[model samples]
Target: MKKMIAVMSGLAMIMTVSSTVYADFGFATEPDEVAAVVQAYIDEKLPGKAVIEISEAGEVIVKINKTSFLNPNQQVNILTENLRSYLLSNDADYSIVRVVYDEEATQPAEPTGPEEPAEPEEPAEPEEPAEPEEPTEPEKPAELVDPEKPEEPEKPTESTEPVEPENPAEPAKTIKPGDLDSSGTIDVTDLTEVSLALLGDRNLTDDQLKAADVDGDGTLSLADLAKLRQYLSKKIDSLD
Candidate 1:
């Protein structure tokens, strides 16, 4: 009676441990879910003759049969690549242990002997030649030189006067810095134009752009706007 109670307790303990493991690893509630997935993967790769066995203890075994054979270590390489990738990516815990291969599962079928080479055929007899015809004369070579020579080109006359270089384009007019509206003075309108340019709605011309570069940094950024505002408020004498 005591032994019977102990055995029942042991069974209950086993069930509790199994449930704990499944909960921790996110194992499927259905007993066949993982096994079915593994079976399908093996079926797709090895077709009808390969079997996959997944144990409740998280062990995996691959069995290759005689009816289907892989091409020399192809089974090992394919399984290692496919299973490791699937587990690492899809398995909740990214863990797989005790993967075993059944090497002596079944004997591979013997290959048929190589085919014999076909016998060579004899050469056919040559036909009789026709009577020799009279030898024909060779054609004359083409003429090497033309009868007339080309006329010589006339030389251009040299100019006695010296040539003058073209005048360069006038440089852009330099304006006082912060003169955004080209009013020749820093005013509220110039500050408003600079603000609009900074907002990106309005564009400034080359001279205006240079003028608005109050910090002389060669760029018309927000710092230029701040400088212009400070200048308008009499915070500074000139941006130069």
Candidate 2:
């Protein structure tokens, strides 16, 4: 009975060691290959550093380095979902155990040599004073000219007829509301123009603005766009 108990104890010890060895050494496929694939996927999808580790139990551990500009939790969730789908699609049995942000170790700053002092600038020399100009001689007085006599005015001829004024120019044609393209009818083209205007991709003319303001609120807004779309889709009878 004592011998039997010792044998069972030895077998249990061997089994425990074997399990540990298998876990440490990895499973059937190389863990490095799995890690490489995971790293590649992370590099392609995200814009940060990541460390990938694999266990014998087919668990993929991902440590994502934290960044100041992004939300770590959100990034982890996104990566988790996408990577899981990607691995499953490729028939990979390995599953992501957990993805967490790791605080990266701060690198030590390099020691810098002492800076040299700047040299003092030399003082500028003073400018010399300008020389005085010589005095000019006085000019002689000119003689005065005599004024000319004025000519007599001519007499005007009398007319009996009166002149008529020219006709005024015609007024500009008014553009119909919602007819942005001025195609004589509102259609998809007009809708596209309104969409472009709303998106700030295209500048609308005064007439186009008036036409695009289907709601007549004096501004082209999403409400106007919705009304225009409804009119086009026949959800409503007219933009009016």
Candidate with top TM-score is: 2
| Candidate 1 local Cα displacement, residue 126, angstroms | 47
Q: In candidate 1, which residue ranges exceed 4 Å CA deviation? A: 1-165
Q: Of the candidates shown, which would achieve the greatest lDDT relative to the real structure?
A: 2
RMSD of each: 20.2, 25.2
lDDT per prediction? 0.70, 0.74
Give the distance in Å from residue 224's predicted Cα in candidate 2 to where it truly belongs: 1.0
lDDT string for model 1 (107-145, tens) is 345598998998888788898998899999999998677
- Badly placed stretches (over 4 Å) of model 2 are 1-164
Clashes found in each candidate (C-alpha, N, C closer than 3 A): 0, 0
Screening candidate 1 with a backbone cut-off below 3 angstroms (N, C-alpha, C), the clashing residue pairs are none
lDDT of 1 at 231: 82
